[model samples]
Target: MSLLDHLSEHHLLVKYTTKNEMEEETRDEGNIRKEDQCNTVKGLKKNWQKWANNHSEYQKHNPFSNNRTVTVQFQKGEEGYGRPREGSRTQQRGHSAHAHLEKEVDELCMIIKSIGEAGGDGQTRVAFGPLFERYVPISNKLVGVLLRARKHGRISFEGEMLWQRRDDDVIITLLE
Candidate 1:
């Protein structure tokens, strides 16, 4: 049922016993509200640090670092502001940098495909599936190769197909 219905059914508002005592009871509840909020903040920060450490370990090779270094500093009695600052550099430049990086990565993939498709000697055709599958196992290595190929204006699609293959049976089965 809805929160209002549940509270009404439990006689939550009737706890004062009489109408005259309602204001006094509400004031008592208000007094402990800040303590509850402080406890919640501490709990949330503890959970965040735990999860952030795990994330940093998993994505160790990622250029973008996880929030392992994130600090949650708040006064004992203060409820910190949750809203973003309108004039912050993080709000303005950060978004543009993120968008630019995404576009660059997408372009790199397209370039890799083009290079892989056009064989230098013009012989047998290279398939994308097998290449993508093989490359995924050594993604760190493959990323380096792609970066080098991009510099020379070549998109290496030769192993693109291999990277697409699912070497992990667990992941493939989950999708099925």
Candidate 2:
């Protein structure tokens, strides 16, 4: 049934003791809906922090002159936005950055297998030249992804480091 119908049926039936109380209940329900509808939107400020121990300039950086998306913050005592209401599905589906990173690693593997040459040993291998040319267009963080893939034993290379021009001939083989 529709929302209004469900609320009218259930909301009224659940506590139908007297006619006067029913009128009060209806008014309270309307007020609750009005409060829910009148929401406030605010732009988020960028928060920046530097790693004091890290020496790399990359680690010591902050947000640049980019206009990021506005975010929502649910304040405490405001019912904490009363969200994901106890055992709700949204509450159960937690977020994980590693899960997405792992998916990127898997995509990297797919790109290698698709573009790379196949060996008689039934392994797919691609040179750094081809892989870089192909993968860089998909994601600029190709080196980081490659390193992650290697760490997961998904792909193997010969060197400790794979630089752009220097390691162009480095063969990245997908391990079974």
TM values, all candidates: 0.23, 0.49
Write one digit per residue (lDDT tens) for candidate 2, span 116-139. 889999999999988899888889
* Candidate models: Cα lDDT each: 0.51, 0.76
Give residue 56's lDDT in candidate 2 (0 to 100). 37
Question: Which stretches of candidate 1 lie above 4 Å from their native place?
Answer: 1-87, 118-176
Clashes of each: 22, 0
Residue-pair clash count for candidate 2: 0
Positional deviation of residue 34's Cα in model 2 after best superposition, in angstroms: 18
RMSD of each: 18.6, 16.5
Estimate the overall C-alpha local distance difference test score of candidate 2. 0.76
Best by TM-score: 2
